[model samples]
Target chain A: MTEQETIGFFKCLADKSRLAILKSLMEEDMYVERLAERLGITSATVSFHLKKLEEAGAVTSRKDQYYTMYSINKPLFGVRIIDILGEKTSESEAQKEREKAYREKVIASFFEYGRLKSIPTQRKKERIVLEEIAKAFQAGREYTEREVNIIIADYHDDFCTIRRDMISEGIMTRERSIYRKAERNGGDPEPAGR
Target chain B: MKNRIEEFENYMRSSAEEKKQKIAEMVRDGRADEARAVRAGLNMYEVMTALFGAALKKTGEGEEGFSREFHILKDNVTGNWKRNLEAAEKHGDAEKVMIEESKLETVEEIVRKFDSLF
Candidate 1:
């Protein structure tokens, strides 16, 4: 079964009324009224559940005389749950694109002409801002502490907080008062002309 | 009779496949409604469990309150089946039957109880 069908099947099973209807049908093929009688629910309600069950591929109906008889759809139930749940589609990629757009929007709102207006209080917004600042440093090149401060101070007055946050968020790394953009930031750490 | 069952089965399989493909396309296009539909299906179990838990908590009033409430709710639900059967027998209008408000309220109460728990 596909994810949608799997979900529908499980959802059909979750209801007490539907379960009762299925249980009654399991013993013998029954029309709507007979099922209503057996299950002690109204025919309308039985029909309601039957419609859902039918959509879920859990039951099949047949016209017999003036009444329609319903029976279990055995093949549908035979499907593996893992197969249903394990299916992955492009929805995840779409979700990633949405998140990326939101990040860009946040950066645009908080920064003016390569300078940050203020430090964002929210961690997620702050991370985006820090990443924007990280772009000022070249990959693989080490800068003295003073050089790092000068670069960061140009973006924001509070160079100390921004600088420290960059280290904490893994946007940059510091060693022996020297700093370089993290490799994960896609910076080329090795300078040209080795 | 046998032929009809076989035909229905074939129809069901093909229709299910078609629906699956349609849903896949919807997901690829990032249709929010498709996501909501899938999520709604997945949430059924959670809703059912919450209802049952809330019902049990509500009926925990006395020594036999839990059991009594459970049976009452079961009967109320199952009783609808019987009532529908009876209505069909009398009026031949089984499809027009309605579930009682009391029973629906019980479910609503269960939902409220679940919300409180969270």
Candidate 2:
């Protein structure tokens, strides 16, 4: 695991409920209801923890008839702390931190109480603003220009400038006045309603 | 048609206490099954109301009026479920007891889920 993944893994495992779930799975692969009964908690709580454990790679699940059985990922548990700490990072951690700091600085400067005060003039900052605005529109869903404006208008009166900037920066795509949030990597577009 | 719409409006506006009183009267009259059914129906409304409040809060449109009403309905509904569970047990009806227990459990889960959102 990378440093971030390792952090996420440890953060997920730090929870008492999740540790209890892992302990339960250590004994046997159990379904949600059974785990809930064993722990004396509700099934919903068990499912919630299971989702986090699954994301952390601490647990794996498989379908068994009508129930999904969860088991501890023994290999993940076997991984050493020293190995994770000693691993080489593919990217510079400092550079990533600097970029995040810069993004936050830009967002903090331009936004006030969830509304944009003014459009950023600098191309880089403008791109950041446009990307943030694009989050309002659902990915893969097509929207009319009017619909886009109505959504954007909630943020600022100058929706036209922000909307135009989004298209120019390729943060969004427009076809026949219909707009869709653009995929960042020019990858295959997501199927609608996914 | 207008009278029916007005009746529904009045029903919707009626407090949970009024409905509970009616259900209590039905029980006092020894109409246990009918009372149980009416209570179940009222509990369904409570569940729906809580779910609606959760949806509103989730969508960032948690109006204060709705929040107040939601709390009122939740309080009444929780009490109603507990009473149902007790009644089922007293009547020695295993199936009804299970149903009431499940409903209570489910509602508690939903309430916890929504409470965490804030």
Candidate number with greatest lDDT: 2
Compute each candidate's TM-score over C-alphas: 0.32, 0.45
Best by TM-score: 2
iRMSD of all candidate structures: 17.6, 19.7
Once fitted onto the true fold, the runs of candidate 2 whose alpha carbons sit more than 4 angstroms away are A90-165, A173-185, A188-194, B1-118
Per-candidate local distance difference test: 0.65, 0.70
Q: What's model 2's lDDT at A163?
A: 88
lDDT of 1 by residue, B35-65 (tens): 3333333333344444345555785434345
RMSD of each: 23.1, 16.8
Question: How much is A174 displaced in model 2, in angstroms?
Answer: 5.6
